[model samples]
Target: MTYIAEQERYDKMTYNRSGKSGLRLPAISLGLWHNFGGINVLENQRAMARRAFDLGITHFDLANNYGPPPGSAEENFGTLLKQDLAPYRDELIISTKAGYYMWPGPYGEWGSKKNLVASLNQSLTRMGLDYVDIFYHHRPDPNTPLEETMSALDLIVRQGKALYVGLSNYSAEQTREASRILKSLGTPCLIHQPSYSMLNRWIEDGLQDVLDEEGIGSIAFSPLAGGMLTDRYLNGIAPDSRAAGPSVFMKPEQVTEERLAKVRKLDELAKSRGQKMSQLALAWVLRGGRVTSALIGASKVSQIEDAVGALAALEFTGEELALIEGILQG
Candidate 1:
C-alpha cells in the first residue's frame, strides 16, 4: 500500500525560522545517527521516518559516517526514499554532512575542497538525490585552510549539489570566520549543528552568541545527552541500550551515580509538569530562541511521539528554571 501523510501533520508542531533564513524548520527534527543504519531493520527505519513526517518533523539529518560500516545509513535512507517517501520529496528538508572518517586515504576525510565536494557527490549518490537541502562540513580540520573549506561549500551551492551550507563541531571563532568567508563568496552560512544538552552545555559558553551574531541557525544534536537525560538509565543501563552497545558512543562508565541522581531529580520535575524526562530535556534546549531546532534520534515511532510532546511544555517559569539550574549545579 502507498503511504499517505497525515492531514493534521502541521497541526501541533512549531516551526522556527532557521536563523534569519527564509526556511522554517520544525521545532523537532529527526536525526538518522542511530537505528537507521544498514544492519538495522529497514522496515523499522521506514516506520520512524514515516512517523516523524506525519508528526510534522520535515527535516532529517545524517552524516556520511553514521553507520557501523559507514555510508550504510545513507543507503538505508535512499531505500526509504525509493520505497515510501518519493512523493513527499518537496515537503521534506533533508540534510547530510561529511568531514568525519568516511573512506580510505586522504581524500576521504576533513575540510579540504577535494574531500567536501567528493563527499557530497558520493552522499548524493548514496541517498539517490540530486541535491541535499543542507550539506555540512562535519567538523573543522586543523590542518586545512579555512578558505579552502568554506570555498568548497560555496562551490557546492553554485553547482547545485547542496542548497545551503552548514558547519558542525566548529568553535565560535571558527564559525565566525567560516560565516564571513561564505558571506564574501555570496553564499551565507545557513546553520550550525552542535552537540548540546542539559548535561552538555559547552555551546552555551560562546558558540550560541557567535551563531546569533552571524545570523546562523543552530540545530542541537544529542539534546538528551546520549539518553542520560532520559529515564532509560534512572534505575540502571539496559543491556540493549546504546550505553551497553559494543561500539557505542556512550560508554557504560559515563553513566555514573552522580549523573543518575541528577537525572532522577529532573525526572521528578518532568512528572510534575506532565512530561517525560526526555520531553523536558528537548523542551529546555529550545526554551531559549537561540536554537532553530532540536535534532532527535529514535529507535521507535514512540520516541518520536515523546519528542514531539516536548513542544507542549516548552515554557519554564523563572522558579522552575532556577530549580533546574540548582539540580544541574547541585
Candidate 2:
C-alpha cells in the first residue's frame, strides 16, 4: 500500500529554528530510544512513524546502541524508510548518534575519532542513509581528548556524512569547549540533546545558558522523565509499564511517594488546562521556546498523537508558572 502523507500535516505543527541555524525542527521530535526495536512489532512501529509524519514531525532520532542487542533500532528504521518513508526522505531530519558501548572493545565506545567514525559508519549502514541531517556525539568521553571528539564530528561533516553536528549529554563547560572547537573547525554545533524534564532539571542549572551563549539549539530527551510525568503511574505502577519492566531507564523504586505527590498535583494542573499529564510536561519543556524541540519516545500511535496535541496550548500564565514552581519546589 502506498503511504500518502496528510496534505495538512504542516498546517498545525510549529517549526522552530535550531538556535541561529537555518534548519527548523518540529516542536516535538520522535526518539527511537524505546520500542521500534527488533524485538517490537514492526507494524506498530510503522504505524507510529506514519502517524508522526502525518502530524508534521519531521525529525526521527536514533543512536548506535538504542536496541537491546544494539544497532537494531536503526535497522528497523531502515526497513521503515524503505517501505513507507522513502519518498519523503528529503523532507525529513533524520539523526543518529554514537558514543555508547556498541561493540566489545575500547574503540567500540567513547568519543575517540576511531569510535565515532566507525560507529557512524555502522549507523549509516544500519539506517541506509548516506548522510544524516545531524550527527551527535552521544556523550562526552572522559578518557578521550575533547578536540579529538569534536574533530571527529567536524570530519564527519566534512565528509558529507552529516549535514550538521551536535553534542549530547555534554555539560555546560563541555558544551562551550566543544562548540569553540567545532567553530574553529568551521562547523558550528547546531544543537544539543540533554536529559531534561520537570523531574530532571539539571540542564537548567547551567546548560541552557551555555547553549544560548553558543547560539546552539537544544532538544530535550526524556521530557516525560521515563513516564514519571504521565498518567501511567498515577494509580501506582502498572504491570505493563516501563517502571515495572526490567529496563534500567526507569525503576519501580524511583516512583517514591514524594514523587507521586508532585505528579498528582501536576496532573491536577494539567486537567485544569484540559490537557493530559504527558501533554503538560511537553508543553512545559517547550515553554518560552527556550528548548528547540522535545524528543519523545512513544510505544503507540496514540502517544504520538497526544504529544503533537501539546502544541495546542503551549502558553502558560504567570500564575500557572508560579504554581508549577511551588509544586516542584515542594
Candidate 3:
C-alpha cells in the first residue's frame, strides 16, 4: 500500500528561520546517522523516512561516513529517496557532509579542496541528487588550510552542487574564522551543527554568542544525549538500546551509578511537569534562542512521534530552569 502523509503534520510543529537564510526548518529534524546504515533492513529505513516526512520533518541530515561499513547510509537514503520520496524532493531540506574519514589515501578525509570536492561528488552520486540542500564541512581539519576548505565550499555552491554550506564540530574561534573566509568568497556559512544537550553544554562556552554575532544558525545534534537523557538507563540498560551496541559513541561505563541517579531525579522532574524525560531534555535544548533545530536519530517511528510531541509544549519556566541547572550541576 502507498503511504499518505498525515494531514495535521504541519499544524503540529513550528518552523524557525535557519540563521538569516530564507530557509525555515522544522524545530525537530531527522538525522540518518544510525540505524539507516547498510546492515539494517532497507524496508525499515524506507518506512522511517516516509514516517518522518509524513509528520512534517522536512530536514534530513546525513554524512559521508555514517555507515559502519562507510558510505552505505547515503546509498541507502538515495535508494529510499528514489523509491518513496521522489515526489516530495522540493519540500525537503536534504543535507550531507564531508570531512570525516570517507575513503582511502591522502585526500580521503579532512578539509582539503580536493577532499571536499571529491567527497561531495561521491555523496551526490550516492544520493542520486543534482545538488544537496546543504553541504557541510563535517569537521575542522587542522592539517588543511582553512582557506582551501572554504574555497571548495564556495565552488560547490557556485557550480550548483550545493544550495547552502555549513560547518560542524567547529569551535567558536574556528567558526568566526571560517565565517570570514566564506563571506569573502561570497558563500556565507548557513548553519553550524554541534553536539549539544543538557549533558553536553560545551557550546554554551562561547559558540552561541559567536553564531548570534555572525548571524549564523545552529542545529544541535544528540539533543537527548545519545538516549542517556531519556529514561532508558534509569532501571537498567535495555538489551535493544544503543548502549548495548558495539558502537564507541555510547558506552556502558558512562552510565555509572551517579549518572543513573541524576537521570532518575531529572525523570521525576519531567513526570511532575507531565512530560517524558526525553521530551523535557529536548524542550530544554530548544529553550535557548540560538538553537534553530534539534537533530534527532531514532530507531523506531514511536520515538520520532514522542520527540515531535514535545514541540507543542516546549516552554520552561525560570523555576524549572533553576531546578534543571541544580540537577545538572549536582
Candidate 4:
C-alpha cells in the first residue's frame, strides 16, 4: 500500500523556531529512543510514524545507540522512510545523535572528531539519508578537548552531512563554551536536548538561563520522567512494566512509595483539568514557552495520539501552576 500523508498535516501542530535558527520543529516530536528497534515489530513502528505525521508531528529523533543491539533503530526507520515517509522527506526534521557506547572499539564512542564523524557517517548510511536536519554530540566528553568536539560538529555542517548541530546532556558552562566555538566556526548551536520533567527539574538550576541568553532552543527528553509523571505507577509498579523488566534506566526500587504519593496527587490534579497525568506532564514541560519541544517515545500508535492530544489544552492558569508547584513540592 502506498502511504499518502494527510493533506492537513500541518494544521493541528504548533511549530517553534529552534533558537535563532530558521528551522521550526513540531511542539511534540517523536523520539526513536526505544521500541523501534530490531526486537520490536516494524508494523507497529510504521503505524506510530504514520499516525504521528497525520497528527502534524514533523520531527523524528534518533540516536546511533538507540537500539538494544545498537544501530537497529536507524535501520528500522530507514525502512519506514523507504516504505512511507520518503515522499514527504522535506516536511520532516530528522535528527540523530552520537556519544554513548556504540561499538567495542576506542573509536566507537565519545566526543572525539574521529568518533563523532564515524558515528554520523554510519548513522547516515543506516538511515539512508544524504543529510540529517540536526546532528547532536550525544554527551560531553571529559577527556576530549571541547574545541575538537565543537570543531567536529562544525565540520559535519560544512561537509553537508548535517544541516545544523546541537548538544545533548551538556551543562550550562559546557553549552556556553561549545556555542562560542561553533559560532566562531560559523555554525551556531541550533538546539539543546536535555532531560527535563516535573519530576526532574535539574535544567531549571542554570541551563535554561544559558540557553535563553545564547539564543539556543531546547527540546526536553524524558519529559514524562520515564513514565513516572504518568499514572502507570500510581498504584504500584506493574509486573509487565519497564521497572519490572531488566531495563537499566528505571528500576522497581526507584518507584518508592514517596514517589507514588506524589504521582497520585498529580493524577488528581490532572483529572481536575480534564487531562491525563501524562498529558498534564507534557503540557507542563512545554509551559512558559521556554522549551522549544518535548520529545516523546511511544510504544504504540495510541501513545502517539495521546501525546498529540496534549497540545489541545496547553495553557495553565496561575492557580493551576501554583497547585502544581505545591504538589511537586509536597
TM-score for each candidate, following the candidate numbering: 0.98, 0.99, 0.98, 0.99
- Judged by lDDT against the true structure, how good is candidate 1? 0.93
The runs of at least 3 residues in candidate 2 whose Cα sits more than 4 Å from the true structure, single-residue gaps closed, are none
lDDT of 3 by residue, 20-107 (tens): 8888889999999988999899988888888888888999999999885788999999998888888889989999999988878999
Q: Over the stretch 1-330, how does candidate 4's per-residue lDDT look in tens digits?
A: 898989998898999988878889899999999999999999999999999999999999999998866999999999999999999999889999999999888999999999999999999999999999999999999999999999999999999999999999999999999999999999999999999999899999999999999999999999998988887888799988889899886889889998898889989988998999999999999998999999999999988888988999899999999998998899
| Clashes, model 3 | 0
Error of 4 at 129 (Å): 0.7
Candidate 2 weakest ten by summed lDDT = 63-72
Residue pairs in candidate 2 whose N, alpha carbon or C atoms collide under 3 angstroms: none
lDDT for position 328 in model 1:
98
* Candidate 4 wrong stretches, greater than 4 Å: none
Judged by lDDT against the true structure, how good is candidate 3?
Answer: 0.91
Assess candidate 2 and give its TM-score to the true structure. Answer: 0.99
Show the lowest summed lDDT stretch of 10 residues, model 4: 226-235
Error of 4 at 124 (Å): 0.6
lDDT of 1 by residue, 268-302 (tens): 99999999999999999999788999999888999
Clash count of each predicted structure:
0, 0, 0, 0
| Angstrom error at residue 18, model 2 | 0.3
Q: List the residue pairs that clash in candidate 1.
A: none
Itemize residue pairs with steric clashes in candidate 4. none
